[model samples]
Target: MLFRQLFDPETSTYTYLVADEGNGEAALIDPVLARVDRDRRLIEELGLTLEYAIETHLHADHVTGGGKLRELTGCQTVIPEKAPATCADRVLQDGEVLQIGEIPVRAIATWGHTDSHMAYLVNRDRVLTGDSLLIRGCGRTDFQSGDAGTLYDSISQRLFALPDETLVYPGHDYRGYTVSTIGEEKRFNPRLARRDRSDFIELMANLNLPHPQRIAEALPANAQCGCLSETP
Candidate 1:
């Protein structure tokens, strides 16, 4: 397997590229629109064919590059089945696995940050947690139909049940941390680690976070799979 993690500074978003080296087929997770070209170039340089562009959820911070990548590479665009965005090529249900070359990417429903949030478990070893679980903190539960209690359960019951050695790759990180293990987060995450459901809920409820600056523009654009206009 081949892997690369790419970051977008403006949104603090992380895009991941995973490929099956034997078949030269690849998939991209949570791609940002502004970095589509760079991502495309890297995919090409790696001599791999793009098979899927997967979104963990509809984002409020930055526009997605899924549609653009699909247009450019004929890659299929995938999103959670419950997400409002209906433009994706595939809408996956919880536990559904999509094959990217030899790799199996399983969609795990982890809704909380948004009504349809999902986390992908890749090849049984690594999980790409889209905003559901961050480095030391979890995603804000103040907007886009977020629920703090549900998020707490999603992490504690579902995600934390994975193997302790499983690697966690989050959708966004503002603190410059790259990766962490399930055991590390389960023991050390300030928000959820070792805390009861009520405690986690209380923490999220009192966060008083500001609304995402790009929500107004990003939501609409993302709903259409990042095609803001037909002029392009």
Candidate 2:
């Protein structure tokens, strides 16, 4: 399997391109519109055919390039089953697996950041954890379907339970820390280190950080797989 992880510093978001080298087929996870050209160029350079573009959730930050990629490469666009999108070619369920060439992509339902959030587990070793888990902290459960208890379960039971060596790549991060092992986060993340759930919730709720300014525009756009203004 061949994988390319691309990061956007402005949004602190990471986009991934995973492929089966032998078959030259690939999938893009959580892509950003601003970097679409670069992503496509990479695919072309690698001689990989874009097979699918998967969204972890309806983004509240930057618009996704899933639609543009599909228009350019004719790849399938996939999102969670309950998503209110018209462009979701494949409404994936929990544990649904698809073949990107030969590598199996497993979709894990992780609804906290949003009601329909999902984390993609690639080949059982790497997880595209959207907004569920970050390198040194967990995503704030203050907007949308953000729930403290549910976020706890998503992290403790669903994600943290993975192997210690499983690589965790989150949707967004403010700090420079790019990635971490599941075990590393379990032992070190300041937010997850707290044993008291109430404290964690309180801390998250009290933070006054402003909501993503582009949310109003991004959600609908993301729902349409990046073409909110266009008719499919």
Give each model's whole-structure lDDT.
0.93, 0.86
Each candidate structure's count of clashing pairs: 0, 0
Clashing pairs in 1: none
> What would the per-residue lDDT of candidate 1 be over residues 175-224, giving only the tens digit for each residue?
99999988999999999866898888888888887888989889999999
lDDT of 2 by residue, 1-232 (tens): 9987899877788999999999899999999998999999999999999999999888889999999999999999888878778877888998899889789888888877678889989988999899988888877788877887788778888988789999998888887877788989888988887567677777777877798888888988887789867557
RMSD to true structure for each model, in Å? 1.4, 2.0
Q: Which stretches in model 1 have alpha-carbon errors above 4 Å?
A: 230-232
Report the Cα lDDT for candidate 1.
0.93
lDDT of 2: 0.86
Cα deviation at 222, candidate 2, in Å, is 1.2
